[model samples]
Target chain A: MGKIFQKPEALADVDTHYCPGCTHGIIHRLVAEVIDELDVRGRTVGIAPVGCAVLAYNYFTFDFQEAAHGRAPAMATGIKRVRPDLMVFTYQGDGDLASIGMSEIVHAANRGEKFTTIFVNNAVYGMTGGQMAPTTMPDQITTTSPAGRDTDEVGMPIKVSELLAALQTPAYIARQTVIRAKYIRKAKQAIKKAFTYQLEGKCFSLVEIVSTCPTNWGMTPIDSIKWAEDTLLPYYQLGEYKTPNGAG
Target chain B: MTHEHLVNRDKCKGCGVCVEACPKNVLALSEDVNAKGYFPAKQARPDDCVFCAICATMCPDVAITIREIADQAPTENKGGK
Candidate 1:
């Protein structure tokens, strides 16, 4: 018998605590796979954000550092600057990256820091009981926005990839999804490219994965994928927002 | 001759993601529950598996492992060193 599929070595053997159907597990696997493929597990320093993936350190076999809410970029920047040989990446959710940590990410990207970011955009804050996040789509109902997100009052959801692309610094920015197998494959390629860019010391790179929050969104795991495909994909748009030297 | 999927019963959370993703309907939630009190996914129709590995990709818990076995014996090497 020959093995066809198995867990990546970068990931720990322990089971994840993520909610069933939650795409966080998928994203985590992709990151770990990328790390393993790049052979950077020993030299990689991951900064776990203060969100649902806050305990991300417990799942990965490599070195992981905890960061304050929205402060992952700051921590990653410091680590990368001091230890240029190490590959540093930040795993942050929509709330941690788009809201409170907005300035941190923007400035880090603007400075063209050599680091990678895996931004898991599930729209609503999963750990905080599905509160309205900056990436929450317009007319999307969350615990904080029970009446649905009013674009007129709060403005439209922030397109983080596009926003970062518009900056003057040279960075690799892309938006992908992991709702299905096809998208999952593409997401892994994007993550691999982001890490590869960092290894080359090119510039700041980020892969914003438009994910689903089944438990937080009050929908079954299957329905959440459908909803994300219909509502989230249209608004968020999946593609490379920017790439260094015009390479996607 | 065919591929088989091994599901880690205790790790599976009965999410049904793999069940829905399997194009051949090769997997289903078992009636028996695991230690976690959730029905683990099982290979209901192992013969239909095409080794596409879609279920393994969709599994959130990394519970599925696919392996293919060769039915025929390997031919002996005719060339000597």
Candidate 2:
């Protein structure tokens, strides 16, 4: 009756290394809260990626494994196979999941790995000085794409959620944002649903979050929200692209 | 008197996302820096707070905790023959 909202017990008391206005912290907190609600804190294991979220291990109280660049899905598969009872997830960014590690993730999802994957698509390689990632929006300005991304040369940003949803494997795939409060609610629900699907042992799950890089985007935190809504959301969109047959 | 919040100044990075998300405009980033040399968000108008928790919902750091006052119960008599 006294507490309305507080940090989840599964989350650590340490401050994250994420930059100010970065949504990675929000996503981490959501995952922690979901883990808390599922009562899987003791059994859960997270695979940290090589990008900006490399230090993701410090934010969660659960166990974590640092994987080589773009090898998180492969590592998660190994851990889940040996210990199927343990809940497992991978915290990967666009550069780690959609680009260099695309093969690993594609194969893992195609094989229907029994684990959850949180794909954070901020549209650029943040840790590496905001290089042009495969998910980087066309016509967007990045360090590598100095004169704005050229659609003619690079095609279009990869829609990883939709691409994975096209596979026949029974999996939960969703893309949501946390730019605003309303979006945060939906994003949390999407994440919770992904974890729920994995808990049921029904299928693999991936929640592709369309995030923002305020520092890299050269915009203030508040302005980044508007830019993400005006620029990023139109291309990435939002909604659950796929769900298991029994998922209702 | 029932509604309140504790913002962890040390953990907060002065992102201002929570301040922008507040519906009642009761929160503001402090001009003075904290131990970490970052401006932490604080309640500017506590009486106007409705405890919507929108700030907590949007906070990336999970530094804000919203709470309510709990009612105290009367002492029970022990000498029950």
Candidate 3:
């Protein structure tokens, strides 16, 4: 065995500020690994959202831009159009994408922007405490929904991937989870494919990764994973929702 | 002295995700805390290690790294040179 596994070079070699067991670190590492694998680190630009991953720029070694809350997709679209040669992506959370930035992402995806998006759906507003989000699971307890989310009043949780897939645009869309080691590999595969689609200028791509927020969920990291597997996974439903090749 | 495994102590938040995923029961959280005040995972029964690499995959902090150094150059050739 010679170097079975090691940290990707695109990632900065330092301790991050993420809470222990937070899957944002895992997703960040996966993106860095994909960037390294594709040899695009030199020309890659990342747009960090305004949520918990706002410090995403600090973790990645490549050039990064901070976007206004819910506006990462719009920023990414502009960057991709201006510098078509560079690889651009946005990292966003549920609240940033499905709520405040819903129109930005929707129109960007509909316009078939060449940039890719990595949407991290932890089901709540993690950065600003456990506030209810558009993707918050029904009957889930959140700071804003202390009595548990009532689907009747707020409507059911928004299925971002499915909603995006319903669009007629030929793009790459996939939903994957990182709640366990087994799922991490699959999630990386989906992420890599999203970037690969962008590399070929196929179309707009969004990889919705169902993640866990241990701090906001008020559970141990392990318990959070179990809770997500039991509660969140059932609703999000992981799979490729769209592809340029017309294969699901 | 060969490094069968290496862990960056500072990088490890000691969430025990790797420990729970290790099928061989090769790792355990140490009693002593690191500089960050978190107890990191250590090899408790290294001989049982199969080097599955799942620990590295599960470690969100990128703390766990697995290395394997063959004793010698690979003897078998599967492709024609």
Candidate 4:
């Protein structure tokens, strides 16, 4: 009999430290599956961020470098420049990527780095006890914003994918979600495409995954998914924001 | 042909994400809890399983793995010839 539906080879054997309802585990599995299918685990180097996924290196069975707060893109840039043969990718959260590391990501993309990034935008700052991140939706209630996010006072939330897509440099920027089976499949496809483009030395590729933070959002796992579908999806607008060929 | 869904009880966190994603309604939170004091998901209706593996896909912890067993074929009577 043929084997079907098992753990991906690129993923570590030990259990994850993610929360029960956190989508980080699903995202990690998707990335691992992509790495396994691409056969780039040996040549891949992941940059772990300072956010909730700071320990992402522990989950993946490959060489990983820990970067400072919002500095993954810079670290990845240096690594990829020095060793062009290796596949470098950064696993970052909304707080790390969209906030403090904004300049690094922008400069990296503008320079047209040949690396991929898995941007997990859970809206709130998960590791920092649910603070208001740069990607936090309008009127969203976070620990820092007890009275809900005041867009007028704090300005609008940064749409990282769209922001990056506006640059003149060639890139493959997409926004995807993994709340359900259908979306998970698409997210995996997008992730694989990003890595494939990087392998071909096309351009900078980033897949912004609109994920859910049930614990931080103050909702149950199932309800948090529903919330994300109702609120986050409409705001984030999931799709291929930019491509090298300029085909949506 | 038969298909079996194995749940690694120790790794399960009993989040119920798999239970809700299972189209066949084959999984449910078992009465017994795991080492983490959480009710791990169990196959409540094994007969209705089609081995679609939706539960495994939605599983966050990679605690579930689906396997299939093919039936044996009949042997030909070569002695008579």
Best by DockQ: 2
Listed per candidate, the RMSD to the true structure in angstroms reads: 5.3, 5.8, 5.3, 5.6
What digit string (tens of lDDT, one per residue) describes model 2 on residues A1-248?
44499889999989888889899989998999899998999999999999999998888899999999999999999999999999999999999999899999999999999999999999889999999999888788999899999999999999999898888784799999998889988998999998888888867899999898999999889999889999899989799888896332
lDDT by residue (A78-141, candidate 4, tens digit) is 9999999999999999999998999999999999988999999999999889999988889999
Among the candidates, what TM-score does chain A have in each? 0.97, 0.97, 0.98, 0.98
DockQ of each: 0.49, 0.51, 0.46, 0.47
Sorted by DockQ, highest first, which candidate order results?
2, 1, 4, 3
Q: Residue-wise lDDT of candidate 1 within A108-164, one digit each (tens)?
A: 999999999999999999898999999998988999999999998999999999899
Off by over 4 Å in 3: A1-3, B1-3, B70-81
Q: Provide the TM-score of the second chain in candidate 2.
A: 0.80
Model 3 lDDT tens row, B43-64:
7777677777888888999987
Which pairs clash inside model 4? none
Worst 10 residues of 3 chain B by lDDT: B72-81
lDDT of 4 by residue, B5-28 (tens): 688888888888988898988788
Model 1 regions more than 4 Å off: A1-3, B69-81
Docking outcome class, model 3: acceptable
Model 1 CA lDDT for position A7: 90
> Model 4 TM-score?
0.95
lDDT of 3 by residue, A82-185 (tens): 99999999999999999999999999999999999999999999989889999999889999999999999999999999999999884899999988888888
Q: Whole-model lDDT for model 1 versus the true structure? A: 0.89
- lDDT minimum window of 10 residues, candidate 1 chain A: A239-248
